[model samples]
Target: MNGANLTLEVLKRYGVDTVFGYPGGAIMPLYDALYDSEVKHYLCRHEQGAAFSALGYAKASGKVGVCFATSGPGVTNLITGLADATADSVPVVAITGQVASPLMGTDAFQEIDVVGLSLAVTKHSFQVTEIEELESTLHKAFEIATSGRPGAVIVDIPKDLQLAEASSKPVLVETQELPVAQTDSIEKANQLLRHASKPVLYVGGGVSLGNAVEELRFFVQSTGLPSVSTLKGLGALDPQDHGYLGMIGMHGTKASNLAVQECDLLIAVGARFDDRVTGKLDEFAPRAKVIHFDVDPAEVSKLRPADVTVLGDFKKSLPKLTTEVDFSVWRKKCIELSEETGFKYLANANNPTGNIDPTSMLNELSQLMEQTSVITTDVGQHQMWVAQHMKFAEPRNLLTSGALGTMGFGLPAAIGAQMSRPDDCVIAVSGDGSFMMNVQELGTIKRFNLPVKILLIDNTKLGMVRQWQRLFFDKRFSETDLSDNPDFLQLAQAFDIQAETISQPGEVTGALQRMVKSENAYLLHVRINEDQNVWPLVPPNTANQAMLEG
Candidate 1:
């Protein structure tokens, strides 16, 4: 069998049903093999979108995502997505067709040093010179991506090697399984919790990867410590759960951000303290003693110093930590904070007038979907609104590019989520500007026959930036306005997908129900007033007290 066929076989063995990429000269052989393969290929408009789509697929499916590309520009185009996945620790396998091995360093046409360029952003990368090495290397890439601290892995295969002939070897399993006792970190982490009066459990994307939600829930329930999430960690605990504080960051709810600052002990699990999450690092958690637990040792103390760092998987760490102590005191404190934080039902407050507020729309959407639906959002004020207002009933319910803050993410991500869990409701909420970034994917959704309800919040502007411009830039609108938008209903009709436009608040629920009930892809373009903005924003470089109300 040829190496290209062998590549397809290995991917099938790994249960990879879909791949996202763009074809180029060096990758023609692989594409030739893919023609006969069952693995579906998504020819993205750009390789960067391909990689991001793969990440979205992985996040939605809880499996390693696969993406293919040709060398040089194709590989370079994947750099940002690789960095994004690395930062968020998403499991993805990027297979790039390289120039022939014989002409490797000759600067052959369209050749680039992909392995070197991607090394910093990937767990490990390979350049296959021999056809016999293909299966084993591909196996290793999947293993590295799914095991321990999940991340992007690059497999660079020389074009000639894919066309070379050899008997395909039996399926290869290359990456070693994670060790059993990553629990040492949990035990040490427990000690930090035991002594502290005000302990806060800071969760991250790693918790979702490890499927440690139950254990974290048990630990939080037992300890009664108020918990806050980085954007990536939004659904780590049930959003409506009593102990859960709202999301913490620049656009996060005021309570969670304040809790991070005031807590005496910070127990960070599976989450990196990115600058946005930490705000001004020097001022972040100045009074808090930090205990960090992560599968990747590098993440510990990467941004802020930790009094104790646990280098292990959160699944093992969380369970072990849960068993070690009495959390009665912790629970009381958390309850107190939850009460103090104004963590209440979404419908508790009412805004009866004006254009459809994104926050109100999101709150209503949460009620409509309840715990059964998974919601994804593109980057914008709408993204923040969903994070702030929507109730996440389960882990992984809220998906977004928190670390990368990439726009054009919601639609493809919703497709991926729909593909993964077809029976459940899936919603992709995007701002007008963000939706336009990758609206071409409407065809992708239609072709796949995925029933994803796309909620297009048409504010006719880059709402987040416009808000900042209004507050911080002395109302210099600059390039923030997106006054012109094509009719989304007509756009959906063009793709052969059903769509409806709703302008009034009263019609919001009916529109959602109609879209959600549809058997095929549906788009609901809710025309929000252009000036409506997401509120409770923390203005840049300002004290917490200086937070601007929207």
Candidate 2:
């Protein structure tokens, strides 16, 4: 078998049944092998879309996502997605085709130093020059990506290697073993939980990635502690659960921020103290003694110093720390704060003015959709609205660009989410600015006949940037206006997809219902007020408690 066939076999052995990518000259050999393989290859409009789609697949399915690209620009196009995945800790394996081995350092056409370029963004990378090492290299790449704080991994294979004959049989790769937290450390954490009068649980995306949702839920329930999640950590506990105080951070809920600030003991589970979460680090959780639990030892004490560090898998460690705490008074205070500061959508039901509020539309859509429906979003005010308003029943149901905050992530991510969960409804909530970034992917949706629903919140300006300017920059606005936007409904129709426009308050529910009920791809373009801004935002360099409310 040639190297290309062997590589495909190895991927199949690793249980990768689907991949997303665009074809290029250098990767043609692998494409030829893909033609007859059982693996399904999705042809994305751009390499960035392919990479983000793969990331969405992994985030939604809890499996390693795979993508392919050719040399140079093909590889370069994937950088943003790679960085986004790495920052968010999503497991993805990107395979890129390189020029022939003989062309090394000769500046061949379409040749670039992919290994070096991807070094900082990837968890690990390999450039395979020898045909014999192809299988093992691919195996290691998969293992590295899926294990130990999952992140993107890269394998760059030259064209000659793809064409070269290999005689070795594909071997099964063993999964890497992760370290467990020390027994004494677990005991210490338990002791801390047992003794604290005011304890809070801080959750992050690692809870879902570690498959520790049940463990975390049990920990919160047993302790009767108030819990708050990071943006990526939303849905780790049911949003409806009384224990959950919603997301905590710059745009976090008032209850969560207040709880974090007042707690005497903060149990951080699988969450890093990201700067956004710990605004003005010195003042964050000022009175709290932290018990930080994480799978990555490097993340411990990398930001805020922890009183006690539990270094191991959260799935294993969370179950072991089973001490209950009594914080009923504290919990009551948190619930009261939540009720006082929670987002309140305006009653647009019978408004005389024909303005459709984005928040109200999101709330109505969330109520209408099934509990298992997956929602993806592009980075903007709309993304925050969904995070705050939408109810997610499962951790995997909420997929968005969290760490990197990539704008063009919604539509492609919805494509991947729908592909991964064909029976469930998948919605991509995007802003006008973000939707246009990779709006070309509508073509991919049309070709695949994907039943992905797009909720385009058109405000005719960069909503988040405009809000920042309005609040902090004296409303200078700068280049944030997008008044000349194209007709999005017509754009979707041009891709052979059904489309609808809703500008009035009463039109939202029916339009969303029609879009959701459609058997094929559909787009619902919503015209919202351009001056709308995400509320309860904690301005830059401010304490989380000092949130700016409308």
Candidate 3:
């Protein structure tokens, strides 16, 4: 086999059945090789969308996703998606074409240093120069991407390398170990728990990586601990569980933030204390004894120092910790907090302020879709609203660019989700600003005839930024307005997709129901008033009681 064919063969052995990418000069030889291969490749409108689609596939399917791009702009466009994957620890393999090794630093046509640029964002990266190293390099990339807290791995293959022949045999790759958290420190954490009056469990993306949703549930159930989750940790606990506190941090619920503030022992599980989660680090959980547990040692004490730190995978540690800890007293405390807080959403709450209420729409959506429909969201007010309102009973039900918070993420992600689970219903909730960023992916969805439903919340402005401006910058608005959206109904129709426009509270349920039940891909343009904002927002560094009520 030629070098390009060999690379394709390696991918086939790895069980990579699908790929997303765009063809260009340096990557053309691989594309030609792909033609003779069995793998299915979807030609995305932009390289960025391709990367994000790969991410969506990985996040939803719980497997490594593959995407390829040409050199220069194509390679550069994938950086944001790579950064997002790394931050969330999603297993994604990104392959980009580069100029031949002979032109390494000469600024050859379409040449760019993708390895250097992607190094920090990726768990590991490589520039494969030798044909003999191709098989080994590809093997290691998958291993690194899937082992440990799974993260993105970038492999840059030069144009010349793709056409070269090598006599080297394929090499087998082995993972040395799954990243393990130290168990020696569990005793110290237990000591703190024993003495604590009020303790809280803060879960994050690591819990998802551990695939310990049931383990977390078992531990929480056994102890009855009130829990708060980072955005990435949503669905780690059953949203319907009474003991599960709502999400914590910037967009966190009122009761959850206040619970964190009042706790005597803060048990942070599989979570990094991000600045967004702990604004004004010195003042965060100041009086509590924090026990940090995570897969990555670097995450421990990186932001807030942990009184007790356990470095290991949550899956291994959680089951062991559950066996050793006694939570009868903890369960009683959690029950009291859950009852006192009554964090359940009240749909009829007074909203006399006249802003377009996104929560209302979210509640409507929740009512309309089944618990089985997998939902994806773009990062914005709508995303937070959905997180707060939608009830996720299953693992990996709600997919988003939580860690990276990428704006143009939903449509492509929806495409990937639909492709990954063709039998299941998939929905992408997007705001006008976010939808426009990658609305072109609508073509991809329509072309594939995937039954992915897109609910476009057309608020005519950047709602999240508008809210921030309202609170922080005296409502100056600035460049938050978005006035140039294509007539979405016509655009969808142009692509032969079923489309509808919905306005008013009375129409929301019927419109969503029709869209969700459609056999073909559909677009629902929800014309919400432009001035809406997400509510129950915990102002930066303020007490949770000071939450903004929409």
Task: Give the whole-model CA lDDT for all candidates, comma-separated.
Answer: 0.79, 0.89, 0.82
User: Which digits, one per residue and each the tens of the lDDT, describe model 1 over residues 1-550?
Assistant: 7888889988988888888888999999999999988998877667877887787777877888788899999999888778778777889899999998888999999999998899998988998877778888888888888788888999999998988995766764756655544455556766777778777888887788878888888877665668888788877786666667788767766777777777888888888888667767777777888988777777877888888877765666566775345556755665576677553432312446646666766777787774778888999888888888887766567778877788887887776677667788888989899898888778777666778889888888888888878887999999987776787778999989888888877777778778777877888898888777765666666444345565
lDDT measured at residue 128 in model 2 versus the true structure, 0 to 100: 96
Error of 3 at 326 (Å): 8.0
Model 2 TM: 0.98
Candidate 2 Cα misplacement greater than 4 A, ranges: 170-174
Off by over 4 Å in 3: 167-170, 322-357, 543-545
By descending TM-score, how would the candidates be arranged? 2, 3, 1
Which number leads on TM-score?
2
Question: Where in model 1 is the C-alpha error above 4 Å?
Answer: 43-45, 102-109, 170-174, 179-188, 322-352, 542-546
lDDT by residue for model 3 (1-550), tens? 7778888888888898999999899888799999978989988888888988998888888878899999999988888888988988899999888887888799989888887788889999989978889889999999999987788999999989998885558477787586565557876776777777778899887887888888888888777777888888888887766767788877777667777887888999888888778766777877889999877778888988899987776677776664345555755665566577544543423445433356776776777778778899998989998888777776577888887789999999888777777788899999999998998887798778788899888888998999899989998999998877778999999889999997665666667779988999989888887766677777887655456776
Query: Which lDDT value does model 2 have at 540?
Result: 86
Assess the local accuracy of residue 282 in candidate 2 as a C-alpha lDDT between 0 and 100.
87
Arrange candidates by lDDT, highest first: which order?
A: 2, 3, 1
Q: After TM-score superposition, what is the CA distance of residue 289 in candidate 3 from its true location, in Å?
A: 0.9
